[model samples]
Target: MHKRFLIIVIGLFLLFPLLGRAVDSNQQILQLRAQIEELQKKANEYRKIVATS
Candidate 1:
């Protein structure tokens, strides 16, 4: 029983860091997507100006 508990505790210690990285990666992806959308909007506006000229 003690050995089983020790293994579970060690497994969790290893798993938590991976979980934290996954959360960070998700946030980074969201930020990148937002930036891409903003840049696309600017490109479309520029296209409109060029088309008019």
Candidate 2:
């Protein structure tokens, strides 16, 4: 019973950081910026290919 309680406590501690990050606005903004930049790069490449073809 003691081991099981310790395991549950450890699991909750490990999960807290992930829960915190899920609600973090700064991280969300950075992720959005990265995705937008990647998509823009892909669009530019596609435009160049279409122009040449």
Worst 10 residues of 1 by lDDT: 1-10
> Candidate 2's residue-wise lDDT over 1-53, tens digit each?
99999999999999999889877977899999999999999999999999999
TM-score of each: 0.87, 0.57
Off by over 4 Å in 2: 1-23
List, residue by residue over 1-53, the lDDT tens digit for candidate 1. Answer: 99999999999999999999999999999999999999999999999999999
**What local distance difference test score does each model get?**
1.00, 0.96
Which model scores highest in TM-score? Answer: 1
Error of 1 at 26 (Å): 1.1
The global Cα lDDT (0 to 1) of model 2 is 0.96
